[model samples]
Target: MQKIKLFTDSTSDLSKQLLNEHRIDVVPLSVVFADKAFKDGQEINTEKMYNIIDENGKLPKTSAPSPQDFIDAFKPYIDDGYEIIYIGLSSDLSVTCQNASLASQSLDGKVHVVDSKNLSTGIGLLVLKAADFINEGFSSEEVAQKVRNLVEKVETEFVINTLEYLHKGGRCSGVQNFVGNMLKIRPVVKVVDGGMILAQKTRGKRKKALKTLLKNALKNKKEITEDRIFVTHSMDSEGAEYLKAELEKEVKGQVIITDAGCVISSHCGPKTVGILYIKK
Candidate 1:
C-alpha cells in the first residue's frame, strides 16, 4: 500500500499539539477585523480574537481558504508520492470543501476531499479517527469511507446565553426580535442533519441550561462512551468546567474539554457552552 496523507482545515478546532501528534496538515482560513486580516489559528488565536471583539463591540468576519491555499497544502503530499485525503468543514457553513475539491482537480487524481458536514470539534473528531485508521495502515479510500460513516453518527449540542450574537451574525433573523425580547429564553442548539439547528429553548439561567444539556446527553448514553464525549466553550472556562463536572455525573465516562478556537469562537461568541457526542 502507498503512504497516505491526512489533511484538514483550521476550522477542525484541533489543537496544535493534537494536529502535530496525528501528523495532520492544516490549511488556514483568514480572519478580517476592521480592514486587517489575520490567518485563523496561525496569526490569530482565540484569546486575541475575543479581546479584539470585546474592544470593537463586534466579532471579525471569517473567510475560507483560497483555492491556491489548498493547492499549496496538497502539492507536498502529491509530490512525495503519497495519496492525500483532505477533510474539511461543512459546505453548508462555508465553501472550504468546494475549494479543496477544485484544487485537487488539478492534482491529477492524487487527492480526495471530504466535507465533514460539521464544524469545530465535530470535524476534529472525524480527523482524529481518520488519523487512527491511517496509523493502522488503512488505505486512503478506506479512511475516507470511515470518516463519512462517522460524520453521520456524531451530534453537537450548544447553549447560547443570548440571541444578540446570533442576530448580529445573521443566524437568527426570523426569531431574533422575539427571542431577544424574552430575557428568560436560552437557546439550545444542535447540529441536526449536518446543519446547526435549534433543539430547545429554556430559561436563560446558566445552571439550568447546563442541567438541560446533561439531561439531553444522558438520553443517548448508550451511544456515548469513554472516548467520544467532547465539550467546547468560548472564553468561559468556568462554565465549561462546571459543565464538565455535571457531564461526568450524568455519563459514566471521561470527557474532554476543548476551547473554541478563533474560527468557531468568532461566530459563537464568548460564554458559549456545547458538547459533541459520537455514538460507538
Candidate 2:
C-alpha cells in the first residue's frame, strides 16, 4: 500500500501539538492590513491581530491561499512517493478549497482536496478523522471519500458577543449592527450547509447567550458522537473553559479547548465562543 500524508489549512484552528503529533502539514491563509499582510497563525496570531484591530478600529481583510501555494505545499510530498489528502476551509466561505482543487489537477492525481464545508475546529475534526483512517491503513482514496462523507455531519456554532466586527467585516448590515448593539442582542451563529446563519438570538448579557448555546447543544446530546468536541474561542478563555467543564460532566467524549485563528477572529471578534462536534 502507498503511504498517505495529511494536510490542512490554518482555519482548522487546531493546536500545534495536535498537528505535530499527527504529522499533518498546514498551508496558511493571509490577513491583509493597509500596509502589510501576515500569514494566518504564521507571521501573525490572534492576540496581535486583535491588538491591531483595536488600534485601527477596523478589521483586516482576509484572503485564501493561492493555487500556487497549494501546489508548493503538495509537490514535496508527491515527489516523496506519498499520496496526499488536503482538507481545507469551506468553499462557501472562501476560495481555499477551489485553489486546492486547482493544485490537485496539476499534481497528476496524486493530491486529493477535500472541502471540509466548515471552519475552525470544525475542519480540524475532519482532519483528525482522516489522520486516524490513514494510520489504520486506509488508502488515500478511502480516506478522502470518508472525510467528504463526514462533512455534513459536523456541527459548528458560535455565540458572538457583538456584531460590530461582523459589520466591520461586511458580513452584516449597518442597521442590524447598530440595533443589535443597542439592544445587547447576542447571536448564536451556526454553520449550516457550509455557511453561517443566525441559529438563535438571546437578548441579554454575553454569559446568558453562552448558556443558551450550551443548553441547545446539550439538548441534543444523544445524537452527538463520543469521539471529541472542540470549545474554540477568540480571547475568551473563561467562556471556553466554562463550556469544557460543563461538557465534561455529561459527555463521554474528550472536550478540547482551542483559540480561534486570526481569520476567524477577524470576523467573529473577541469573546466569541463556539462548541464544535460531529454527529453520529
Candidate 3:
C-alpha cells in the first residue's frame, strides 16, 4: 500500500519539530506587517512577529497561501506516488481552506482538502489524529471522514488578557462591551460550530481565570485522555506552563503544551491562555 501524505498550514499551531516527527507536510501562510510580507513560519518567527505587534500597536494581517503555493507543496507527494490529505484552518476563519481546495482541484485526483472547522492546535490536534489513521493503514477517504467526525468533537476555549487586540482587529463583536467595561473580568472564549463564541465571563485575576478554564475543561474530561489535551499560549510561557500543570493535576492523562503560531497569535494576542481538547 502507498503511504498517504498529510498536509496542514501554519494556522494549525503545529511546530516544525512535531510536523517532522509525524512526517506531515505544512504549506506556509503569509504574514503581512506594514508593507512587507513573510511566510508564516518560514520567513518570520513568532517572537519577531509578536515583537512587531507590540511595538507597532497592530498585529500583522495574515493571508492564505496562494493556490500556487499549495500546488508546489503538493507536487512532491504526487510525484512520490503518495496520496495527499490537506487539513487546514476553518474556512469560516481563513481562506486557506478554499485555496487548498482549489489547489486540489488542479491536482486532479491526487490531493484531498479538508476544512478542520477549528483553529490553532484545535486543528493541529485533528491533523495529528489523521496522521495516526494514515499510519494505521486507513485509506485517504477514511482518514478524511474520521477527521471530519473528530473536528466536531474537538473544542477550543481561550481567555484574552485584554480586548485591545480584538477591538483593533474588529473581531470584538460578541464580547466587546463585557471585555471593555470589566477590567477585572476575564472572559473565556470558545469555538462553537465554526466561529469563536464567548463561553463564560468571570472576574478576579489571571490565575483565577486559568483555574476557571481548567475547571471547565474537566467538565468534559471524560472525553479526554492522557495525550489528547493540547494547551496553547501566545508568548505566555508562564501561563501556558501553569495551565499545563493544572491540567496534569486534574486530567486523567498527560497534557501537551504548544506555542500559538503567528496566524492565531495575531487574533488572540499575547498573554492569551487556551486549551484545546477532544470532548466526549
By lDDT, rank the candidates, best first: 2, 3, 1
Taken over the whole model, the C-alpha lDDT of each candidate is: 0.83, 0.93, 0.84
Please say which candidate is ahead in lDDT: 2 or 3: 2
Model 1 pairs whose backbones collide? none
Best by lDDT: 2
Top-TM-score structure, candidate number: 2
- Predictions ranked by TM-score, top down? 2, 3, 1
Q: How many backbone clashes does candidate 3 have?
A: 2
- Model 1 residue 50 CA deviation in Å: 2.1
List candidate 2 stretches off by more than 4 Å.
Answer: none
Colliding residue pairs in candidate 3: 226-253, 226-254
TM-score of each: 0.93, 0.98, 0.94
Q: After superposition, how far is residue 39 of candidate 2 from its true place, in Å?
A: 0.4
The predicted structure with the larger TM-score, 2 or 3, is: 2
lDDT tens digits, residue span 1-280, model 2:
8888899999999999999999999999999999799999999999999999899898999999999999998999899999889999999999999999998999999988899999999999999999999989889999999999999999999999999998997888999999999999999999999999999989988889988989988987998999889999999999999999999998899899998999999999999999999999
